[model samples]
Target: MSTEIELPPGDQSLLLVDDDKAFLTRLERAMQKRGFSVRSADTVADGLAAVEADPPAYAVVDLRLEDGNGLDIVSALHSRRPDARAVVLTGYGNIATAVTAVKLGAVDYLSKPADADDVINALLATGEAPPAPPDNPMSADRVRWEHIQRVYELCERNVSETARRLNMHRRTLQRILAKRAPR
Candidate 1:
């Protein structure tokens, strides 16, 4: 079955900013197949340059990049083209960052590994109604695990710092970190 989404008549230019070369290439190809004039950048600097040169009508930006955060690109795009539709994609998804993305004019905030169809739908959605719930929402255990993992990463993977920040016992945090992520 075709996953292509028909975009409304307008400028179909799309800017995709991601650090993962493989993911960027795959998403670029997929978006092109779906009829977008796709432009991709693997770093925040390149992404900002693309936005300055010519802001696209749509954007799918990774929240984290090698040089800087992708939110910078999103901010620049919105400033250049207020009407542009932007979606922030991140592996470390959190409510605070999602709110910030929306405040900075992103149309949506999606977790990493989002498919082309999901990105397209988020870009084209009219915002007249709330988005439908995920078909397979993360379980509570998974959510907790993800949060802990995010915290651990933000703490520079220092178990002591992460545990202290989380108000969790060091041994407990270590145990959780050692276990595989919950589905």
Candidate 2:
């Protein structure tokens, strides 16, 4: 005697768009385990095409795509498939972007390094759907401060080495650091 076995797929499918290969692979596995059949595209164009053809129940899109920006994808998705839910993932992590993504059609947005579980939770929290970090995490002032601190700690503060390494100006950097040093 012989037996035949088959498994039924879940009703909810997901589209994941990101340029990071490792992130996409890992997310694919995780989402699959969570009963979501995930389709991945490294570029926004491909994602748009997939969505057009298949129209998944949900989409996890990156803010930055290889071929084009993810914002464009979000806009298109919102305009084309109003029924589908979407979430935007980004590294820039700014409030403006998050708001824009939502206004465009994403249900919510989250920053990079967000875990699969967290992402799943966020999607669930959205009940459908998809900013930036506060003020450039690496602002010019922060850069100047760090550059000076590092240079001083090394006891050299050599303009050439510090500036060259940081791709900044030896003189300009020095001036910035000096401007903030309790003077």
Candidate 3:
């Protein structure tokens, strides 16, 4: 028993940009079910082209695409359509990147695996009131682990590079990576 989300009255055109084909397809179908006319792009170039061809009223863009960063798309969308609402989705979420996304005109920054409901709420939120706290926020250990994992991934899984970038001992990072994620 879930309450239906009421979209703000306007164009329902939406652009979905993500390198993950399966996730993109899933989100596309879900948004369509909720009445958005969805168009999708799997690369930064394609996303930019789509935005240029037709600016969408709403956009859900992944932070890291195979070809380039998704912020490019967000920036282009904002430039083309200042009234558009956009959300930045990422697997490697951090405070700095979230701030940058907001500054670049994203209405919200959501971590990956966000459901259709969460995305819809973000797209429609008026920002007049603060959002409620998460029911089960990640623990400090979990947050640290996630950050380390993100760095490791960004460093292309090179232990030395990740350790140097994080300023952490190689052994420490290796041990942390070896262990299972904290609750």
TM-scores for the candidates? 0.78, 0.64, 0.78
In the range 79-182, model 3's lDDT, one tens digit per residue, is 99999999999988899999999999999999876778778888988899976555466688887887888789888999999999999999999999999999
Candidate lDDT (C-alpha), each: 0.91, 0.73, 0.91
For model 1, give the 10-residue run with minimal summed lDDT. 1-10
**Model 1 alpha-carbon miss at residue 14, Å:** 1.6
Tally clashes: model 3. 0
Give the Cα error of residue 86 in candidate 2, in Å.
1.0
Pairs of residues at least 3 apart in sequence or in different chains that clash in candidate 3: none
Looking at model 3, report the run of 10 residues with the lowest lDDT sum: 1-10
Candidate 1: which stretches are off by over 4 Å?
1-4, 20-26, 64-66, 90-100, 111-115
For TM-score, candidate 1 versus 2, the one ahead is 1
Candidate 1: RMSD over Cα atoms? 3.0
lDDT of 2 by residue, 27-57 (tens): 9998887778788899988988987887777
Residue 103 Cα positional deviation in candidate 2, in Å, after optimal superposition: 0.5
